[model samples]
Target: MSEENKKGKNDQFGELVKSMNQFFHDKPVKGFLQTMDEFFRAPFPFQSAFPVEVRESKDEHIITAQLPGVKREQIQLDILDNYVTITVQSHELFTEEDDHQRPVRRRQSMQRSSRTIPLPQPIAENKVKASYQNGLLQIRVPKQKGKKILIEGND
Candidate 1:
């Protein structure tokens, strides 16, 4: 082909690549892939994000979880009957600098992680308590008691 034709074809190919990139970046599918990418990039996709342990006593159940680099306000704990759910939302700030030592782009990203665990016995929601110290989160839930039934003796 002629040089003019080659140049035109190259320009068209460049435009096509740019359009594809933009489409991929602005699509909801990209958002989903990004979410999955974030999940897979965590310390351990299945466990390390919020490693939790449950211990049960005669009167109560104790739960402990480790959340490194997270703030106390970022943690939310929910108790529903015998199940305990914990959610943590964290934010990270990223800055891109130019050669002149000036920031060219700045962005803040948020990640949310949640885990639900079942207790050995049903718990009393009114008596549940939770506390966070350092990077450790601890929760105490009082076990629900069943009332004994009294039966009348027949003659």
Candidate 2:
């Protein structure tokens, strides 16, 4: 090919690359690609699960996590005054039975969920109570009762 033709082709290629880069830089496609990359390289997203609630009262702090269709034995909880972590894992197996001569196909799936919560102050370890019912995990963490600061009348 002629030198002028080669130079023109190179210029066109460079301009195409620049325009593509500019378009992706100004859009969410880059973020989508990043997520896809992470999903392929890792087992789960860093923040996949967000179904949890924390409630506090004078007596104790309660943390409830919604984990429907998960077995009781698959849930774990660790409690501390400064932080609490919960992890839930489930595995399901599906099977098809054939009486005479058909082939049976089975599929197994696994799901894992985890969450971390931070508390204002440390609580007693022995005072923690946890329960799981109806696919809901509930934890009651009793805070170390703090001394009340009585405010005197203004001078």
Candidate 3:
């Protein structure tokens, strides 16, 4: 190609690259891509490893989580102040043995997933209750109990 044509082609390629970079770095596009990246990177998209649902009532908060393919022994629950954390851990074992009863190519892997939720009101840790059944976890956190004290000077 002639020098002029070569220069022109190089300029056009550079412009294309600049425009693509600008489009990808734009605020809206970057934000959307970040959101999508997080969703896709999670073990379970939108579920954040597992689905969690919290329901609030006048006195207590009810929290439920879906943990399909998980066992009761693999689940853990923790409560501190007004926050609830649920963690699930599992281990996988693989072994390829020959007929001679010797082990070859043995591998063990561990996986853990967790989620933390904040409650609207202070919880009564002693009064909190949890249960796991059929790969489902339910936690009830009761609001802290307090005696009523009247304030007269402010009125």
**Residue 149 shift from truth in candidate 2, angstroms:** 8.1
lDDT of 1 by residue, 1-155 (tens): 99999999999999999999888788476866776786678734234357888888888788999987678988888878688999997677877688999986676767788989897767677788999988889999887787989998996
* Candidate 3 residue lDDT tens string, 1-155: 79999999999999999999999999778867866785568644223368899998888889999987788898888888788999988777867687997984565657778999998767678888999888789998887768999878965
List per-prediction Cα lDDT, in the order shown.
0.81, 0.80, 0.82
User: With candidate 3 superimposed using the best TM-score fit, by how many Å does residue 145's alpha carbon deviate from the native?
Assistant: 3.6
Q: Kindly list the per-residue Cα lDDT of model 2 for residues 66-118, writing each as its tens digit.
A: 87767789877777658999987767685656797564556566777789999
Question: Candidate 1, 5: how far from true, in Å?
Answer: 25
Cα displacement (Å) at residue 137, model 3: 0.5
The residue-level lDDT of candidate 1 at 112 comes to: 81
Off by over 4 Å in 1: 1-48, 120-122, 150-155
TM-score of 3: 0.61
Give candidate 1's error at residue 118 in angstroms: 1.6
